[model samples]
Target: MPDIVNHTFENMSTAQPHYDVIIAGAGPVGLFLACELALERCAVLVLEQAADPDSPLKRMPFGLRGLSAPSIGALHRRGLLDALDLHQRMKNPFVGPSSPGAKRPAGHFAGLVFHHEDIDMSQWPDQPDGLPASLLSEMAELETVLARRACELGVTIRRGAAIAGFDQEPDRVTVHAGDETFVGGWLVGCDGARSIVRKAGGFDFAGTEPEFTGYTFSAELSGAAALKPGRNVTARGMYLQSQPGFIVLQAFDGGAFHDAGLPVTREHLQDVLRRISGSDVTIETLHLATTWTDRARQATAYRNGRVLLAGDAAHIHSPLGGQGLNLGLGDALNLGWKLAATVQGRASEGLLDTYQAERHPLGARVLDWSRAQVALMRPDPGARALRAIVGDLMATRDGATYVAGRVWGLGTAAVRIA
Candidate 1:
């Protein structure tokens, strides 16, 4: 990338460094965007709310993330693909049911598996051998690697601070975070679902209501033997024990529990688990746990004057099929170059507008994908029948190929340059 540019924030009042771009959130998306802008010699500053980037939730089973075709291609093109070693070591979690000798399936949709033999690789002949259609990664690993790259390219990351508020001028944007103030030519928000920038920037988020509250965690279970292995579709809900203590529960509660923002205690977890699993399973020790709903929403516009939105700040959906992380990464990749060009005075008249025009449709499609899964996962007779039909179709070559293509983001066109 570009040479390191010296930036100091020792005393905000003494010397406040100016930047071409100021990004909110130090997650993978924000960090990746920083690296992209710095690659073109644009001074960048990243403001993160958390004091420490390290978290247990960002590692292992809890933080497991999937890299789609576009994400892999983007990293490879930037010469950062070799820096990732986790995918080579970690096993693919998308692989379906196993037998004594069965060809491991490539992926799934709503627990319906699709085999490798069924997918027609000829359909995606444009895929190069060097870049796989999809790979496995961890959130912690991705953020660490991307952060390292961003720092190398002269991006300043300010942790323990966030975009509390900002003012947009005709020439630049002035951001206020805690007691510090920073100035930048343009501001991009990559902060998560409840983005302060998106809210303060007056972006309208529109989407559908959730059908269920999903839980993911690792806990000690007293009646572990009662719970069946693999994904079990019960009349109450769906439960999956991917590993010994790692469990995934989908309770059809109309997303009430998750929306209430109640604490995820062991007693509540056991109650939900018992109800969903139809087993008398009790969580002995709640190690790690988090709750999410299939609530899907997208911002009406990605950019507002000098302020922009990317990653989860732009859109959000259920973590089903692991589309959330990939979608955010795709957003950062799509916006970084265009925003840099605009800042550098090399962009065309409508270059920045294309960011939303092209990406919005894709984001909507992903939201619909999550909604469809929620439909199939419903604990109703109609949904059960539909799930059966869908499962049967997924076993077919054509069906498997189509679903796999979408899941892995195959056949996605490259960004057009002005």
Candidate 2:
């Protein structure tokens, strides 16, 4: 049971509707979980606070790889590729000893594993399945696609219905949404950082201080005729360079970043771009700007009794290596089927508990590396030495390849649910 907050405006005493499973958010993680459950013919209800597509920041919008290479194998196991409409958002895999694309390009230090430059896609473990049978990326579009799939599978998506309260018993939960109520045999909180379900469910999210925080404005750079030569300055952000926080002047085709405090003044951005590119460049940022603070963290528990957490609810970490949303989606995908089975009653209730033991350690590793990488990003002297050591290590054949494997997303493995 949770501390009840009574309200007058939204009808506090409506009879709650019953559902096999009720998810408190309609974000990508929640929607994806809904789709996964609907596949098993589990009745699901997704409650989203906002109305329509303008449903707040339901999913992070960036052209980020959906999941790193290792987890993609897990996706394959779940038949996610076959189920979702993810055809274009795929990356070239680079893991283990040999990757055809690992060779450095001539002249520029773009491909060198040292400095972690030019992010090698080849360092991730090879999928037993060849060439993405179905590849998808970019979370903004992902949300829309997954929602449609869940609907097709008969999952009911309720919009503008914020969770006002919930009552949880050992076997079921009754949810309060403005004017409506829902009962569920199980609940999965794939909600965002400020999760009401998490709060109502009495889950404690223990987090270390945001060891580091940075601001970013992902620029929609329209390539200037004068800026053509500076395109080679594709190294990710101000890391390995002497700068306060990271300033990544990337060719977006449309790209995104989570750094804030980067002076959005075109002159400031252009100046930073010129400094990094070593060339006079002219670039214009399209009107959209994003300001956010990223912290390295993971939740102490992935579950709280019948209520479970996934995605940002379970962990919030630095956006380095573009792992935030990827990891969240993986969390949704990992917990979805088990929840589906548990709700359907084919599996024992204990199945859901495994989510914590499996995912917590993996997230801890992510948190540690997120801190280490951000530490490497800081312009301070200690970080400088650490970067130097990293550079030196990458300079060696074994060290470079070894570190490259980790940096490229091969190091993390999935929390095996079975």
Candidate 3:
């Protein structure tokens, strides 16, 4: 079990609630936002549904998440960059043959690799110094680091307390979790995709339907040795074995199996793998499994009166290019200081509103980015030809640099849309 520390309010006996801000999730986004608020002396209370922070899915290769340039810069600015130790240890999958003058690959888009030699960093004249274009991070370690910082800065996190419902008034929001009621001057829902706060708050979630059902799992396989390594986008579907026994499968089921809400079983895994890989792979034992789809959706607005939304609560997309976490972290980063200034009465007339204005467009772009990947991932001759063309372009200097700039979330000046 993961170590869970819960803080109890000493004034529980009193009628008035003590917190200035109430957060509805203890995930990285919420925790980081709490750290930001606490840094400026705002009392924050984070309510989480999970009793423990540790999980098998958050460990090792399974939990591997790539940190983009912006994310690394945010961590460095907060003085927590040195706390990350995994990037130095994990083998860089993109590091090509170490022959003389070999170009290490930076990242990929829809499995099309981009090399560092092609990316012209000089294009980014305003780029900050001493920051890698990208880094690898584990989800569990990220949460642990952010959580520790939040606690140190006096943010109270209450585990096993899911926000059941909330009532927002003119000046404050009343949050109901378990049998207790906590009040805060403002509420931000950093809860995930199926956010209860979003549902209860009546936010409009708009997006495109899913094209396929995606699976990520670990299992014991008898004929796994027959399968090749790395990502393979087959006509039937896509399959990637980042490591032995750990696999990811994308089956074009029109998101049926995922929306069916059926539990993942060994039989299902075997069938999917065999069909996708065209190999008689037998699953001897199923260690872990989960299903998702490309059902991209985003809240029309991030704020609803005094109750606001962030992270997956505000937007959700396919985990293509590992952009889900990065996008959420960006939301927290963009909103933290703005919302903090608003809460502290230091914000200008429309500073608080800029959070939604700036972030909503970015969220839309990410959704489109995911959708574009899905379009190319289709098992058709046209998609295959397009993928090949994209691969060719990615090998070019200008193409790789452009994609790298977008992937690392760089080379954008704030533009006003009148």
Candidate 4:
């Protein structure tokens, strides 16, 4: 049966590029949707410009390490954890190490992976790991699992196949990826911010560009002695105790910081870490730095004709709260089952259309809420004072608990269409 889908893909003779469903992009969001659709017994094809999942070409270091609790909850509700072996798999190449430099060992340190009622930044030494539970997988590990899962569920994935253009008819979509053509009953764009799918589908992205930009830095810890004990520091940030302030261990995926809106460089970053941590941390794995301008934008809609949008293709904003990947996957889950049910004739056709109605607003709200988060990260005196005030207030016994729940993304929902 799976080979059947593969044969369909290779058998296409540019006959208007057909598919039961075609997905543009192979990120976790798109891959997960493909997995869901395939599980539901839908014939699905995913077209990615990259090569195979295991290829070094697709190897990208982790940066968006923060995953919201709500996303975890959603995945749990779908029984995807045991199905995907998420916990065990998440432990695969687990997201980070305290500092980049060589410490006692790699992937060491354990304890305290949770945020508590008291915003006690000084509670680090007592509890080692820093949080109770974190979305432990690095981006690469997560993507690999999702890709394999999608393929296992019978999704025909064509790597190095980029969608050049697309046209949507009432009941199907025609996609042109390089020299290959694919036809599908439904189409979705998961191609990140610069989505050819959205443009080809003719749906305008709606939302405001936020005022901040965040940076993800990857560096290795050279001196083991300086920062040997990474996780035993105060709750000042993510990295570890031994790491210098300039290069924080907060974003363990990479020993870096989001820096709200400030533009920074390798030299500047190193300098900042020195100033903050009071350690002249040597840089080892200066892997890659990605800067994304925070724009609190949302798609005016998630659907147009027979095509749909998911992940960064649908909306993008600050990566605050580690929400980008999680949000996109959530959108896919909601849309996938509904679309699959409709495709199988198990639900009204209108069920598929409700995807946009419910999710677009939620995406926009997340954008705005993230913008507010950036506002607090700003360094201006007034902004710092404001943040302190807000942080202090939120740190209040009740306030901290309430806001923590929301930060975990358990506080809201999109309206369901009847």
Candidate maximizing lDDT: 1
- For every model in order, what is the number of clashing pairs? 0, 17, 0, 37
Candidate 4 on 184-239: residue-level lDDT in tens? 89888899888998887777777664453334455665553555333332222223
Task: List, residue by residue over 18-100, the lDDT tens digit for candidate 2.
Answer: 67888878877898788778877888888778665442222333333435554556556655555444554343221112246
* TM-scores, all models, native as reference: 0.95, 0.71, 0.94, 0.72
Better of 1 and 3 by lDDT: 1
Tens digits of lDDT, candidate 1, 53-73: 888877756577878888888
C-alpha local distance difference test of each model: 0.84, 0.58, 0.84, 0.60
What RMSD, rounded to one decimal, does every model reach?
A: 2.9, 8.4, 3.0, 8.2
Q: For candidate 3, write residues 172-223 as lDDT tens digits.
A: 8999887889999999999999999999999999998888999999988898
Window of ten residues with lowest summed lDDT in model 1: 1-10
Q: Ranking by TM-score, best first?
A: 1, 3, 4, 2
Off by over 4 Å in 2: 1-17, 54-63, 74-126, 132-136, 211-213, 218-286, 395-397, 400-418
Q: Model 4: how large is the Cα RMSD against the reference?
A: 8.2
